[model samples]
Target: MDNLSRRDFLKASGFIAAAFALWRCTPREVTASVQPAPTPAPTLATPLSADDATTLTRTLRRITFGPLPNEVARARAIGLEAFILEQLNPESIPEPDILAPFDFETLEMNAGELLRVDPPGRPIGELMGATLARAVFSPRQLYEKMVVFWSDHFNIYIRKGIERALKPVDDRLVIRPHALGRFHDLLSASAHSPAMLYYLDNASSTKEKPNENYARELLELHTLGVDGGYTHQDIVEVARALTGWSITRPRRFFGGGGEFVFRPRLHDTGPKTILGQSFPAGQGVEDGEQLLDLLSHHPSTARFISTKLVRRFVADEPPEDLVTRATQTFQETDGDIAEVMRTILTSDELRASLGGKLKRPFEYLVSALRQTQAEIEPNRALFRYLTMMGQPLFHWPTPDGYPDVAAAWMGTGSLLARWNFALALAFNTIPGVRVDWDVLAGEASAPEGALDTLSDRFLGAPLPEEARSLILDFLNTLDAGFVLPALGALLLASPYFQYH
Candidate 1:
């Protein structure tokens, strides 16, 4: 049998054209209004019917990168509530030693130690590899998901000067430690992170000329929404309050530097007012601490954080009622992240949003690797695909992070990149990444049976009737040797697999 060319692959997989046609014809706008209140949280103790099992599958799909058969079985066996509760408290779950095989030396180093490395880019590469490893292989799936969430929430661009060294430190010390902790503690840790300070120009801030870059983002992007009711004057005052929050400069001979340090001399000794709250004179780091307290506990912060969480896990435009409930939980729990996630995850809103949220490039890639059980080297060969798909890890230039909306990722170029990736991965063409069709598909030899097996394995359920028919027809056209890889590529690139 001749090896299939790219043109032959696309021609054989007619479902891509059909899926694109359906996508273009369908209205992407969601018009559902927020319910006045949430329906009572579903009781999980009931027996599992087909519909119940499907719901459980959807829940696992949303929370983890993608659902494995074992995970799906575990969720069904443990029941929904227990599964969610167990994921929320990640410490109780024993994690697989996902990083044991990789020798990423810089992941454990401080910024000062990273700066001294011979090749400056190695640390960033290792960090990205570790991140992909965790997402693809970690058994503590929800915890890894939250790590991605907070990494975006408090974004720091790695390409920025000194940030290349500092971001790994920030990821290890600041983001990972506090991802599932209290929001206040997370905010405080980020405020003091040298990567964040340097990336946002707060490291150079002084009493004489305070930089407002970090302060503006702190208010607008990190905590409060754009409509969170603050003025430019508040930004100025907050920047003033955050003055002297700087990192120690790396010395030439000694290996001591890159640590956060507060300079009392550079601090604005005078009193200041922020968000209508008064700060007395002679305050130092307390100014920033109090400011974080004010923002973290504010009603607007609760709403803002809740709305973003709901948007991430539920829908593009968050349902107002779910946001309200999550906000109430946030306020009630003093910004406890786990509890707020519990409120949103257990609500009726997420249940209704099954297959509604589109996977961004990173999610799409990681989910594919997870679902296929691909053995990956976690190197630039794999990372380059994400770069091509428009979401290079830790590399979004702005503070807003990668956009979470489906529209941001639906470009023709991005879609083509996804298709190319599906082909490469399915054919085992990517260097250092391998997918075994025999193991993944099992004893299914015929095209029809293989299609059914692949569909159930990838989608966590049978494909829709129309989609199944289109794909099976495509498979029937291929020669016996080409059927499995073609079917695998077609399913991975299909729209059914694009959404969670």
Candidate 2:
């Protein structure tokens, strides 16, 4: 599949119009580890459907970063539910090949080891590079997708001092391990993560005067929905319950210092009532642990988290019926993430939400790389381009990560930026990345034949007739050498292509 020949290209051209348009369509199930979501907003574009191959490919488009042909084939071979089960248990999949070559220097480092390194090694850069590389090359697509979701849900700004070093370790230890495991596990891991402590100011929270930063966000943002019905006093009580849950900053290890610590002396060992539940007067670290337990199982937490999951995988408004069903799954299973994901993926809501999502800037960039099979490296180009496109990795200044709805990202400027990127990538113009024209073009040297292959490659089925004609007319004006590549670019930048 990687090396395309003239014969194969000709054969693929014949498949353009028939691959996805109206012909014997049937729906199928999908899997998790997908992308963004925010508070409910507008519904999405027209949902596309065709035959089994088309349905499977489109479903893969939802769960994975732009579906590679090989991934599509594997899904067909194994069948949907089996493949989703494998993705849910990423441990069953062999380790990704990226582990050795794309190594981030601080991946194995604890907070202390990272602090000892000179200049800090740009570990954040290496970590991000690895992340993008995995998006492109890893077979553990659903696992990687879940990591993206959890990373955003428990976001930590990398620009902060120690966080530059600590965030990568947090990704390695806390987030990735439990991304698809269980909600309670994910919440507890975030609470214990030194990076989270540092980012939220919980590290300095004390018994005498506790900080409310983490406490407020933990209720309003993390667990309960904004309207989840907690009061100011509840926030204060939650803050008091979290005192002395800090980092061990003493200079003990060679790499410098910082580990999760429970300083009993600094803790407020007083009676506390949170959400109408009482805590005994003298407890230690268990006070905070119990808080996590309470919040993770709360009815509001279940609904809040269920709504986000539904939005991320299904649609913008998140079907009321689906949210209620998923909430029950969350509560019934005690926050089992994998089961909840399966429930969401196999629902009628997802089947209706075929082409309903607008790709966020990050998804747009990463999916382009995945489709074009770009040879990306850890460099300033990705950072600059990602920033310019308006969704720099882990750089949202506010605690509420990048807006996941179309309204926030559908402005004229961001759309134009996306178009420019599509053109540059299709034309092989980006530095340090190569777009193989031969592999992309195949036997289609002329504009007409080129459109068939281009549509087949990018849009899965044939391009709609109107789009096909406009693209063909546009290609005719270009020089002979430019037609095939330009055809690829036009298809990528089209409005229809943006929704999936």
Candidate 3:
């Protein structure tokens, strides 16, 4: 495997030669994190011009969960464009290592089975655990990142009645597979998913009393964003067009039970107008289907989605040129997410926005796990911190999803919370989370050597002289029993680590 380049590794996984007759599974090797050399190669602390190094680190941070010790080496070896391409075409990559400790049974269960499960938190726990595990360990970092982004985009509360059951199924069938695929495909799938139907109360919608909850969100949140020029009448018209697009009863245990169902009897068979486009009387499910088609391809929708992508990848305000370029790519490519992402990742604006965005709490936790290479078997306590920081997975409680910028998360109290977790993690006191400081330290010893190792592993470079001296002075106050772990914790808690 060492001799094989990433391309060759993918090509050779099934056979020695393409013309040869053979079959094989994608090697389990593709899933696990590739261990770097015990000692990092001797290299300049900062190898490029200040701006270029900043851009490179920013690229790695945006694409991956966080920076790894060997991230720069690997990206340099492959070239940044090629690295971005690999992540964009994730099918060419193999499946990630399964979370062996997790059963995943509840996620796979039918809606009826999930609704019947007596205990509630088990499904939520499994889903959250899997989310953290994948972000920290999967080799296909970009794909996992997209899955998370979409989960938020189409958020549903796990504790909301039948949503506790429908949400996991929605994740598996609708969100994960299409996260990096076409926007139209993803939009269509979410429109037909049971969890969404129930959570938004579209299942109970009828021609007699149309529920505008799903329709309003579909226009304002899902496709055409709030400023996408939709009127209240358009929302009502969309509701009329979507009447009877719903799910079967959860009590049904057979056939397409608890699945999407269009009850023709409940559908509005009268003429309707959405965004000034008219639907003739006597139409049924096609009315809603047509509405989905219109919104997915609307020019406003393309701009809205593109703006959000640019904001997430580059900066909160988003550079106008990048947005213009990305919106053109989105409309030209018919919302090909991969191409849109490529446009943003390759842009000068994204590079220029270095260190401009702050890490969200969810990002902080996962980055901690990835940098430490901790042994993570999901436990209840591990997820409690997520709840505490107010970014609980699949629990945003509204359609807008969690905020992506820095100001929303900069409270002194939240900073203190992160510091506490960082110290606890390094001390090996966080239940079910374990870090191997001895293995991480290798042959490095004492204050100077340990700080060097910690900086190399976590920051990919040394800290400022003042910060380094501060940590060293603090170490002088501690005993041998606490010195090593406490120092590592201090590194994790540093302001540098807090940002990227």
Indicate which candidate wins on TM-score.
1
Model 3 Cα lDDT, one tens digit per residue, 169-252: 898899999999999999999999989998899998999999999999998889999999989999998888888998977663
Backbone clash numbers for all candidates listed: 0, 4, 0
Residue 267's lDDT in candidate 1 = 96
The prediction achieving the highest lDDT against the true structure is 1
lDDT, model 2 = 0.75
lDDT of candidate 1 over 24-75, digit per residue (tens): 4334433223321122111111111238767788678889999888888888
Report every candidate's CA lDDT.
0.83, 0.75, 0.75
- Which portions of model 3 show Cα errors greater than 4 Å? 1-55, 69-72, 252-256
Candidate 3 has which clashing residue pairs, if any?
none
If both were scored by TM-score, which would come out higher, candidate 1 or candidate 2? 1
Q: Could you tell which candidate, 2 or 3, scores higher by TM-score?
A: 2
What's the distance in Å from true for residue 116, model 2? 3.4
